[model samples]
Target: MSKNILIVDDSMSLRQVVSIALTGAGYNVIEAGDGNEALTKLNGDKIHLIVSDVNMPGMDGITFVSHVKQDANYKFTPIIMLTTESQQEMIQKGKELGVKAWLVKPFKPEQMLDAVSKLILP
Candidate 1:
């Protein structure tokens, strides 16, 4: 079965780009506008991985990740932070929250696919 990947970002264009890339690679893609919407998408479905942006309108990536980590259903799911923020402190915080990888904005789709392949659950 194809793995499900949830992509959370404020930019619709960014989400579309990522969704196309992931779906083309044979994975199922779920999209959300921001952290709040992303949480709603977590409705007991088996999401193999999550791609999130650090800066969003509703809730930030770090806070969203913390909430995810605390949930038993998705606590172990791998997460990749895809954002423009390259600050060390933000990266460190994400690492502490169990983020699997950090991909800065303007990343190549191939790079993201590589990270997804490496981290997505079998």
Candidate 2:
């Protein structure tokens, strides 16, 4: 079975872009507009990885990661923070929440693919 990826972001364009890139790389892509939506999807899906953005309307990426890590069922899933924020504090917060990797926004498709490939087996 193909690896399933959950992409949490507010920007439709970014979600589409990431979906396209990952789909081309042979992974199933699921999307959520915010942290709440992501949490909802989490219950019904079998996700192999999570790619999230830091700033969003309701729940932010850091908070989302925190919730996921706190839940025993989802604690071990690999999550990558993909956002424009490059601040050390933001990255550190993600690290504390068990985020597997952090990639700054405007990242190349190949860079994301490489990260996912390394994290999830094909």
Candidate 3:
């Protein structure tokens, strides 16, 4: 079966871009507008990977990642941060929270897919 990937971002266009890429590559996609909504969507689903944006209204990507890492069910799922914020501090926070990869915004879909190919759990 194809892997299920959850993408959390406030921007609908961004989500569509990502969804198109992943779905084109034979992966199923789930979208959430923010971290809070993302958390609610995680209700006992067999999600293999997550892609999130950092600067959101409530529960930014970093905090959301921390929560996922702490959760018994989703702790081992790999995550990628796809955000406009390229600050070192933000990257560091994501790394500490066990984000598998980081992709700054306005990214090439091919490059993002490469990271997904590498980091996604089997």
Clashes of each: 0, 0, 0
Residue pairs in collision within model 3 = none
Q: Candidates' TM-scores? A: 0.97, 0.96, 0.96
lDDT of 3 at 111: 93
The alpha-carbon RMSD values of the candidates against the true structure, listed in the order shown, are 0.7, 1.0, 0.9
Off by more than 4 A, model 2: none
Q: Per-residue alpha-carbon lDDT of model 2 for 44-92, expressed as tens digits?
A: 4678899999999999988898899887777788999999999999888
Ranking by lDDT: 1, 3, 2
**In terms of lDDT, which candidate is stronger, 1 or 2?**
1
Task: Please say which candidate is ahead in TM-score: 2 or 3.
Answer: 3
Judged by whole-model lDDT over C-alpha atoms, candidate 3 comes out at 0.92
How does candidate 2 score on lDDT?
0.91
Question: What lDDT score belongs to each candidate, Candidate 1 first?
Answer: 0.94, 0.91, 0.92
Question: Model 3, 1-122: lDDT tens per residue?
Answer: 99999999999999999999999999999999999999999999899999999989888888889889989999999999999999898788788878889999899989988999998867
Assess the local accuracy of residue 61 in candidate 2 as a C-alpha lDDT between 0 and 100: 88
Which candidate's TM-score is highest?
1
How would you encode candidate 1's per-residue C-alpha lDDT over 11-70 as one tens digit per residue? 999999999889999999999988899999999999999999999989988889999999
